[model samples]
Target: MPVAEPPAQPPTTRTTPISPSTPASPVRAAVVGTGGIVTGSHLPALRELHGRVRLVAAVDTDPARLTAFRDLAGDDVHGYGDLDEMLAAERPDLVLLGTPPALHAVQATAALRAGAWVLCEKPLCLSLAEYDAIAAAEGTEEGGTGGPYASVVFQHRYGSGAVHARELLRSGELGRPLVAHCQTTWYRDRAYYSVPWRGRWATEGGGPTMGHGIHQMDLLLHLLGDWTEVRAMAGRLVHDVESEDVSTALVQFADGTMATVVNSVLSPDEVSRIRIDCADATVELTHLYGHSNDDWAYTPAVHARDDERRTAHWRTPAADVPSSHAAQLDGFLDAMEKGVRPPGSGTEARRTLEFLAALYKSAFTGRPVGAGEIGPDDPYYHAMHGNHPDWAPKEQ
Candidate 1:
């Protein structure tokens, strides 16, 4: 498909499935990662849900971090050094996968098989086959009875501007989307990479694209739909670790829309932005410093209709939304009650994992990777062969 310029305004928007004010019933939950993000994002979001959810237990390899959560949450909170032991005893309704990227698939599959709902952090897994396994293992039904639901963390979609943007697309106000450009640049100091798994391909997956840019990718796919092919290049240009610090990709979606994805972990300052061009108009938003709550710029494209005519156009207004992580969990709880699929089911996350796998394949073989080409029966299934991304020294 030929690539065309994005429309001068935002694409039409779509609304999320969850309701805003409906109170949720408390669901027993277990958290696995005691890392910074768990505190900065997920844990705080969970806390906000309050009576709707319970912090039954938490697990971490580090005894100190485990104790920290135990103290903050209170003494009755069960603390375990191992997830397996915790699952066996706690028997919680949910498990939060906060561990490194590589451990996500293995840990999530185990939790699902044990009949516990799962909320795994982004960049779901390192390989397509692993993603397939997670999808296959999801749900507790007859043919595949007694499994738990799984969802990947994509909180940005629940942001106010993002929700408004999606609503516009669904309302048919922006016309058809034809193009999207995404840029994700974040600064990472030596201290940041000091963690054992930060930049390693074996553990953290690839650098910024998988780690930092994953959210952007999710937003892009969520708005513009699936990609059919991708051509990308990745290299290590900063930090000292096993994965590339910068990467870029050319993406072609099934609807014939095209995109450019630029990501890096070497910037002195951070920025996340997406520019979408649609048949009706163009729209762009710049998010400086990664937080969606504030510090984001939204520019609607100028249209042929001026002043009065444009004013008559159905204007999509931005409204506040909860953290995407919380929204996802809330959706899961609702689904469990209604017996419906969650907003982001395990199958849905498989699309993102497929994109990641294709990305690595494209980067490694110096070729374009097509969607669905890496099937379950492919020899690369379960394949984990990429070299540790060079986290030190500049290279392209």
Candidate 2:
């Protein structure tokens, strides 16, 4: 994988005029931290929103990266080196926090406090403390007449296939889930970890687990509901880093369901897969490089439910599930417009982050770390303060 460093300072502002064909009321969204994934994943997704979302401003430490964003976003896309300054100046309807996972809490809190609806990138945060802090900053009750909104970016959950899968589970088509399996495999070359923050404990956080596995884990938690406990192990088997390059966990959900997850950055080819075993049958969904629930295969010993009723419940067509990022983005805007709750709020994001933190604690202490074990006072809470808990290095 090729890793390029972001440039420094804000570039010239740019804007592309909205036409009559565009949405009647466009939501102005400012993007903070236009480096790495922000450029690759977020920018493309934002573009797909068409007129509903306008790129009004951007904040980043790198000037060249800001210029690149401006070039693609348009002339009206204001650039700022300081996030607070940009928020005060542009006063965008929404703010997208594209910084590293470790910084998610602070950035998200600031954005919300500044009265801009925020859409934070995935993993919610890197540590449990960060999760708690963000959660504490949230206001679920109508935001007190006029207040900033908040939503996390778990695009995979918003997909048509994922939604359909959830409906099937709810409909008892798969019975009660007894087990689940998740695999998140991708290759990250040495060059990919060459960035200043990459593979570092103080900045990038964990390697594959936090950086890549989080997406799959988010899906797992969403599908399985709450977890009771987890036993896990992690090791830096391939990548040169302070964090694990490969990790696995044994997760037990509150419903007495069990699951196993394997996340790695050493696989030659990328694959994201999940399998759920219910009492009456099994439902499996698999895809490489992305998620598509329409391709899922539901194998039941027999169609326990009425065929007509099951068919009628299918909300998504058989076609490929579109990008969940777009749906998630639209969801946030809708929440803002309707004065209701966003689909992926910071409080919801806290659960996933807490789960990840517990996994780390369990792996390090060689004991099961329950949900409440990691709280605001723990030293490793809120992203381990960008520290790598003591772990033995693999033998050379």
Candidate 3:
């Protein structure tokens, strides 16, 4: 591939920053949903930024979970069963949503309308229509500026390895990326789908393509810039579920790069990987859930292998920062403090979501899907599944 160097920063819609007169006190934050994600990721990340973020409240429909959250978050943190009640009481500066996929749009919109910035988990919402509604709630509909914005948690795009790779690719140090592959294959037993919302189209969206592989796809789009089209196939396979258990897509990027992507919940030996073959070198990352600098490797092409200066540049090491909620949160807080939309907010987030929607549309329609093809009039705009395939179970 012989592509030009793109802009250094990711594409984003310009929005007015918060007023400089705002108080310098720690940002008051509340956690929505006391699920495993909250206890395992968001809570610890919040605690890591103690001086900058004060955990003020938590919400969960289940009383026991709420109580557990209160116990772990300390007495100062109040617990509530209702999100709206907690929002009204705490009036937090930030809201971290760890709820199920179906509730994300409603909860995030509520938080945004309440003048709170939101950090939501991946697969931000079920459809582009819901995404636009959340964007409108961010005050962009009136004047693209001011209070409240929503960002998705795409931790894989953080960390030293990904950052370095992005810089190298952007600067043409890795020479234009020609071919690539992204794999997100993990095993999930039948018990996993017993969680009610786990495999449903109305709730969890579109199987591994929407939920599991989205992280890697987002990272791929982050490094490659923009994708132009996608051709895909999906199936339920071993699992008796409303959505497919496995999916594969052939993606085309604007820079003439062609990439193969695979998302699965049936692989015996699980692994998440991304490999980019460029004119000068091949860069790869291999890890399960998260990765550190050690998980990355770079190899120069045969013709360029003898170039000492180029090889040395690729070998230089950076601080070993693992991809985690804390890493992404730190950057989000920086953007918040500066009064700008974070990396994974606004258009940047929608880009990833739209791609997934297109993948599903392609699979179900038995045709290729293009970027900017799905609009308000398109059925897929309202739901990931659109007109359900014959194989899809009917809604109850």
Candidate 4:
């Protein structure tokens, strides 16, 4: 709270600037996969970043997708069928990984070793062992300062509303966060799993808990800090997938706070929500995929003097900005240029993964799981389902 602010920085925010380059050359940027997220999000965000980033190369196994990427990226961009070939031919300053869960670690580690900052999508890796491998390649300060490293994509935490709330909690304005609720319940038809990697633990990690609700739960961890323990149950429910269609957990925080977390893909009427009950007020954010100022609400406690005053305190920036891959990509690029690890860097990303591992362990073993309970020695750490053959049906 006492940190000094940088000049010309955004209101109430801190940023580090880097040494000036020739000013003509932009940061070299490339993409590793031509999946939906990459086409729909990453490419658009990179376009938004314009002259600050130069489009370099793109990699994809599918010739049709690679041709599409080249068309969008331009004729100057090199297209490659292999990741190693692309990295070797063009040593980009930044590499965006939109590959599947199983390939993220290997791709990211290769990029980091190639001396480029890395940005990978959600569910970073399948296991902590893989996470550690990425971490080793990413050994550096946050925001790419000491050197380049891999960071996960969890952009909701970067929105103005979420950021403002974080400041309020940090300054004790909202009082200590107590009981809370987080829900990530959305519907995914059986056809969605037709893509081989969608439901299997080996390819996509766990189901809704690991893949879908992780964004909301990660925001939960960002706001409330460390969780001490978790009791949870995950079930296949109605989905024909190999992983749970729904999961629920009762979580305990280090500060004695508690929260009920629900992750699901079976809810007909879908929404992503989080309500934090602070001693002084209750702050809530409700939105489907991404959020803007309109998605946030604040309700003060009965003892509060005036609702107007609380609104004044909780007012986000006048500008409306939705949380998205573009916003996080901007932040990651800024951090990379400044020689910092960037938002969603390995450590910050690891915290969320650790919590997930704990949840999966608790659900699989039918017992309460502690924060560090599932490590290299734990079976659940390697295989999310552990040895519970009865827990899920064979992947169809």
Highest-lDDT candidate:
3
Each candidate: what lDDT? 0.71, 0.72, 0.86, 0.82
Candidate 2 TM-score to native: 0.86
Tell me each candidate's RMSD, in Å, in order. 10.9, 5.8, 8.9, 8.3
> Which ten-residue region of model 2 has the weakest summed lDDT?
11-20
Candidate 3 residue-wise lDDT, 1-396, digit = tens? 111122233223224454432245777889998889999999999888877788888888888778877878888888777777777767777899999999999999888877788999987899999999999888543343454789999999998889989999999998989999999999999899999999888889878999999999999999999999999988878888888889999999999999999999999999999999999999999999999988999999999999988788886365888999999998888877766677799888999999999999998898999999999999999988886734544334
Estimate, for each residue in 193-264, the C-alpha lDDT of model 1 and write its tens digit. 988877776787667877888888887888777789999887776565667778889999988889999888
**Global lDDT of model 1:** 0.71
TM-score of each prediction: 0.84, 0.86, 0.92, 0.91
By lDDT: ranked, best first? 3, 4, 2, 1
Candidate 3: C-alpha lDDT: 0.86
How big is the RMSD of model 3?
A: 8.9
Selected candidate, larger TM-score, 2 vs 3 = 3
At residue 59, candidate 4 shows an lDDT of 88
lDDT of 1 at 97: 84
Clashing pairs in 3: none
Better of 2 and 4 by lDDT: 4
